[model samples]
Target: MRLSDKVVIVTGAGSGMGRAIAELFAKEGAKVVASDISEERINEVSTSIKEAGGEALGILANVAKESDVQQLIDRTVQAYGTVDILVNNAGIMDNFIPVGEVTHEHWERVLGVNLNGPMYASRAVLKIMLEKGKGVIINNASVGGLFGARGGAAYVASKHALIGLTKNTAAVYGSKGIRTNAIAPGGVNTAISGTITAPNQLGMEAIGRAGSAPMGEAQEIAYAALFLASDESSFVNGVVLTADGGWTAH
Candidate 1:
């Protein structure tokens, strides 16, 4: 067990890659804190983990809200003593509309969740990690962060900003025993696509041309997270691990 006795917090653990990561971490002996906007979904993931003889705690939270994120950290500490890992995986997709077609509402919503959410969570967790003098943070970025046209203006902008955050966090805290990294996953089969509008469907289809690698499964990405969260990645920091199936190879 790579993460035996580690305390891990995985945001957006209600479904998709987040959920898979939570389950896998639990099996590897990490005490998992599964948080999501949906109470039912998070609870279900928590219940499954416990039933399988793993430790878990479910919390309902909107990562974009600082209050909710703070409370999440407080509760996790109260239950588990301290946080050892944080996976900022909770995120939303934009409608894939170009900047010219994007609305102010859409831009704010996407950035609030995709960018600000990670910042809020990282801020809350840093206090604990800093005091302990050791921790890990893994941000879920995307190929959209690496290039244009993979998603809408808002999504691309938000992800790119996230990569910046990851680097800054790593630089400022690496010597303090904290590590931060980002994962840029390409086309993983997940529920984020439901947010796509009809007009933007064409943009989604164009993803096929970017990579010959098959669309990734949630578990595939989860495995990547596992490595970053574990002791094996102790020497790795401030890096963006591209799990984009060769999308950027072009």
Candidate 2:
């Protein structure tokens, strides 16, 4: 058990990549706190974890809200005493549009979820981790963060900022036995569709409808997160691990 006796908090656990990561982490013998905006969705994931003989708690919270982020950390501490891992997985994508045509509402919503939410969650967890003097933080960045115009203005900006946050936090906490890293996932198959309206979000599919790159399952990204969270990555910090199926390479 790579994570035996570990306590992990995973946001956006209601569906998609977050769900897969939470399930995998639990199977590795960690006590997991699975959180999402929808109580039903998060509870479903929690139930599955418990049925598999793993300990888990379900939480419903909007990550963008400070109160919710604080409660999430408080609830986890109450349940497990200490947090060994924090996965900043909660995020939202705006209807992709050129910045020239993007509305302020869309920009705020996108940043609020994808950037501000993670920032708040990180701040809340950092205090706990610093006291413990040991922990890991993984951000769900994107391949879009690496290059130009992979997504609309807001999506790309949010991801870029996430990467920056990962690096900054990692640097700040490295001396305190903390490791912070990010996974820049390419394309993965999940059920969180219908939120994106950008015609050519992936770019590869945009030019001649080339179709999206060879995509991996969300479990693949989970594995990347797992490595960073586990002691195996003790020497690693402030790094962005790319899990995109050759999307960034091309």
Candidate 3:
């Protein structure tokens, strides 16, 4: 067990990459906190982990909200003593709307969940992590953070900002035994596409120009995250681990 006796919090644990991370972390001997906005989905993931002889707790949390993020940390400490890892995995996709066509509502909603959520969660957990002088923070960023046409304006911007945040956190806290890093995953089969209700032709055309890459699985990313969250990555910090199967090699 790579994470034996560790306490981990994985937001958006209801499905896709988040669910995979929670389950895998549990199997690695961590007490998993599977958080999601949906109560039923979160409960299912938590129940699944326990049924597999792993320890897990399901908590409903909308990471976009500060109060919810605070409660999440408070509840985790109340249950598991302390948090050893925090996976900022909860995020949403924009509808491929470029800046020209993006409305304020769309921008705020995307930034709120994708950017503000991680910021809030990271801020709350830093206090706990700093006290212990040892902790890991993994941000599930996207290739959009690295390239321009991978997503809409808001989505790409939020992820780019997230990677920046990851580096800044790592630089400031690495000496304190805190490792903050990010994973930039390529296209993966996930429910996040459900958020793309309205696609913009210009944005779609821009993405088309970039060409397609092989799709990855949620578990594959979970493995990358596992490495980052474990002591094996002790010397790795403030880096963006790209798991895009050479999609951006060209």
Residues 10-69, candidate 1: write the lDDT tens digits. 999999999999999999999999999999999899999999999999999998888999
Regarding lDDT, does 1 or 2 come out ahead? Answer: 1
Clashes of each: 0, 1, 0
Q: TM-score per candidate, in order? A: 0.95, 0.94, 0.99
Models sorted by TM-score, best on top: 3, 1, 2
For each candidate, the alpha-carbon lDDT, in order, equals 0.91, 0.86, 0.95
Candidate 3 pairs with clashing backbones: none
**In model 1, where is the ten-residue run with the lowest total lDDT?**
205-214
TM-score between model 1 and native: 0.95
Single out the weakest 10-residue window by summed lDDT for candidate 2: 202-211
Error of 1 at 199 (Å): 4.0
Off by over 4 Å in 1: 201-213
lDDT of 3 at 20: 96
Go through the candidates in order and give the C-alpha RMSD of each one to the true structure. Answer: 1.6, 2.1, 0.6
In candidate 2, stretches whose alpha carbon ends up further than 4 angstroms from where it belongs are 198-211
Best by lDDT: 3
Ranking by lDDT: 3, 1, 2
